[model samples]
Target: MADDLGDEWWESQPAAAGSPGVLAANANSSDALCGPSKTWIWTELNQRASSLQKPSGDEEGRDTEMMQQDTAPVPEPSQETKQPMECFLTQAKETKEETRKTKKWKKKKISEILAKSEPKPGTPGDLQQLIKDHYSGSRSVIELEELNLPDSCFLKANDLTHSLSSYLKEICPKWVKLRKTHSEKKSVLMLIMCSSAVRALELIRSLTAFKGDAKVMKLFAKHIKVREQVKFLENRVIHLGVGTPGRIKELVKQDGLNLNPLKFLVFDWNWRDQKLRRMMDIPEIRKEVFELLDMGVFSLCKSESLKLGLF
Candidate 1:
């Protein structure tokens, strides 16, 4: 029965040579049957896939060229071109340093100039010599004028008088006691010293002790009585002259007078002369005289004393 069924199936299958189904199956299987055809199909598929996947050698080469162009080297600046800039910077630095140094030097010089400058005549020692000479009876009126004091001398002279007067008032009792008990010769010497001191004091007073705005003439008038006495005493000594020391000694013994009066008298006489006046009027001389008077009478009087001993 199986053999009979097999025989029936075989009869139902069509023959391969003339059947359309058989032809269609053969065409579908042609790639597997032909090696060259299969190889050609694979090569064409790979070519198309590679074209879609990545860049070719030509495109890669173009990309490489662009990268190289982007990274091109820039030239460095030449030393010759940079030299001028460097030099200019150096020169500017040096110029600033030099300017700083110059300013420092100028400041130093100015400080030195000011430091070395002289003090004004109104300061100490201004009238030291004038006071000394006036008291010691050594300086003549001409010599006083020649001294060329500053205006400050007069101001200081006034100060000296005020100071001395205060001192005298404080010691007046002692002076009076000394006057009464002392030998005539000793008394005379003391008196001379005292009188000279007082005259110096008076000179200073005359200069500084006045009220404001008075005329020179009126001022002179105010002190006229004492001034005349001073003048008279000065004239007496001048008339006696230095050669008449004996006469001067006798006169001192008799009158308790001192050489101070003569000295001041001489100074005044010389000072008041037209010639001395003209000289004193000169700005330079006037300044000098003022300075001399400001040094204080006591200081100048001491100097005159030394000169007197020498003479």
Candidate 2:
């Protein structure tokens, strides 16, 4: 019985070869044997991946563009945005105008001060007032009393309305006669005391209009030596002498200047310098002027020989 079964099984195996199972197995083996190459498979995979990535990258770019649009800046709503710039401009203009006004005010103030400082024309009482005002603190009561001068002590100043030349002409009407008779050397017929050498020179120049070819000596201490001045005086007859009080006092002390022939003792009293200071305003000059007066000028005035003139 076993031999017969073995023959039957062998026969069944041959029939199964043509069945669906055997055919499906042969198809799978064939597919495995004829599969695509490695490079073709890689190329296919890469192409699919690139196609999918391209859509995703495009979508991402569109999303970023939409976000940028949403966050974009907008224009201002009104002209009110320019208010700060306009305000700054307005403030600058106001500051400029204020500065201009300040400068103008300063100029006006300076003009007023200068006008106040300028000296006015003097009167007969001007001399007395000035002497009192200037010497009240310095001189004693006795000295102040001594320093007093009557109306006769001062020359006729009503005609002295203008320049030094005009004043000289008004006061010294007989200057020519006096100059002719003034033959003494180292002596001057008229002595004009000033504050500085420059003033002395100025007075001398002003005298050209009044004094016609008559000898006028400069008696200031600037440049010229005392001995030279004394020698000049001794050699020439000077009709008019214009000098500072200090130098005049010095010369008088040295006997280089003679006051015997002096008729007009004129003081440049009313004149003011750039500082608005008069001759008596300066302490040293005032002292010298007083000393010069004390050195026989006051005595001569008391005797009515030498008249005091304030020009």
Candidate 3:
């Protein structure tokens, strides 16, 4: 019964109905037992309160510093480093275009040069030189002798000798007259004309009724005579008709007028047998001779029949 009364008295004490002094007395009692509990409480409370509340000024300062670091400007590439690449690309394009233009210009220049350099044919100077160089040669004079008869003489005998002789007399009068004029002064011209006349005589000898009238022969001989003192110009005579070979042979036989002596005399000094044969063998020589003969510029006959054979 006493213990119960004591317990009741402790529970019902006035301290329990706390006052400021009473709370202070309890804090003092706890502090005395724990020894500086305020510091530990303050630390723990600060940490927990900070986690729960909005950030303080110190924390905000740290965050702002980190954001400033992130936003800071990085160094840009230098102008010098970038310029070369742009310059190189620009130069490459320019160089390629320039090369293309250069090639086009070169081609144009080459074409222009070729056009300007092309040769003109049939110039007057060229024709004159051709005549002087080729027609003035002894070979040309010899080639003139190959047109003794027309190729189709039998069918057109009248036309053949008549047309041929007339053409020869007209075209070659200069050479023929030169032969007569310069027989002593120019042996070469004399020989060439004499040879030509001999070939002409051979053609005349082969004609039918063309007995080569004495008067006509005399005029022909006078025109060709090499003497300087004789004035031997006569009216032009024309031998127009054709005669048979039998009649021609009879006239030649009756008169015993051998033309071989004149032929041999003309050909003897100018031509050697081997050289003549070689010249005759050349296809170009033969063709040129035949063409000249066809044009009635000359005449050719068998040198053998004219007693020009080396044997």
Candidate 4:
């Protein structure tokens, strides 16, 4: 059966044209904790391909004729024909000018988006203010619930002074000593939470410099099952775990994840998805994240053992 399906069989089958394939793919990509996540690159590629597409023969033929008329003198025509030809030339020139302006505007918009994508360092105070602003317009009574916690719960900002590996060393100076002394097989010393499995995977790759000999596991719900994660946690001495909020919440609820051993809880806080929305901006994900914090991390905050980092 595996041989028959061949490679790439498990990937999502793209829907037919005129279908909601792009929208559907984007929706799943955002909540990829439970499924494979695809990037918005496909949509970008499609848009590029469309822009590069050659105009139809009708339009091309008109352009060619217009060029020839402009370059070569034509025999004098009747008054009626001359007026329409002049109008046609004027319309064509206007269309060309409009197209040029459209392209220029698009380029400017793309640059603006790229600039906005850059990660800016923020203090714990900034994070608190952002939370307050996000919920300031509480239209309903239920939305009035306080999501922001005390300032002591948050660690200092990354400050862009060091690479992720070096930052980890600076923050957790005794990591080497703790790693050796830790004996729990079912708990992680550090847990990094992100918005999606795709980001989690990226974080795992970045951990190469920091992980060293310590075991790092991806705890998202993409291809792995809850039971499988439970077994891995029970059998292996995991030092780090990277996952999304929903799956992490589920694991903790099932007693598969132990927060007692967690010393550092990092949020992939500054990163934004293609839609320019942060993890907390997404309604479902925001709820799960707050819920996860309420589960056990809030209690751990009282002790000096657990420190929260906004990465």
lDDT, residue 149, model 4: 60
- lDDT (Cα, tens digit) per residue for candidate 3, span 1-311: 65867676754465531345544555565555554676664455456545656687899999999999999999898776567788899999999999999888874433465467852222223322433444455456554333232322211112222343443343334433333343221111111111233444644554323222311232123244323212221222222212222222222333322222222111111221322322223444334433432331222233332211110
Candidate with the larger lDDT of 1 and 4: 4
**Model-by-model lDDT, in order?**
0.38, 0.79, 0.35, 0.77
Better of 1 and 3 by lDDT: 1
- Superposed by TM-score, candidate 3 places the C-alpha of residue 202 at a distance from the truth, in angstroms, of 32
> Which residue pairs collide in model 4, if any?
none
* lDDT sort, best first: 2, 4, 1, 3
Runs of candidate 4 with Cα error greater than 4 angstroms are 1-119, 129-150
C-alpha displacement of 233 in model 1, angstroms? Answer: 16
- TM-score of every prediction relative to native: 0.23, 0.59, 0.23, 0.57
Strongest candidate by lDDT: 2
**Stretch of 10 with least lDDT, candidate 1:** 186-195
lDDT of 2 by residue, 1-311 (tens): 65868666743453243345544554545555444664464455456546654667778899999999999988777765557888999999999999999888874443476587854555668767766777799889998888777678788663336699888898889888887887999889888888999988888888888998689888888998889998998898888888999888889899988887788888887777777777877889988887787788877876788788778
Point to the candidate with the largest TM-score: 2
Q: How many angstroms is residue 64 displaced in model 4 relative to the true structure, after the best TM-score fit?
A: 74
lDDT per residue as tens, model 4, 1-311: 66777767646465543345654655566665343224455556466556556577889999999999899976796666457788899999999999999888874443476587965675677656655665567535454344546667777668766666777777778887888888898899998889999999888888787777888899899989999999989888888889999999999999988898899998777677887677866888887876787687767876656888977
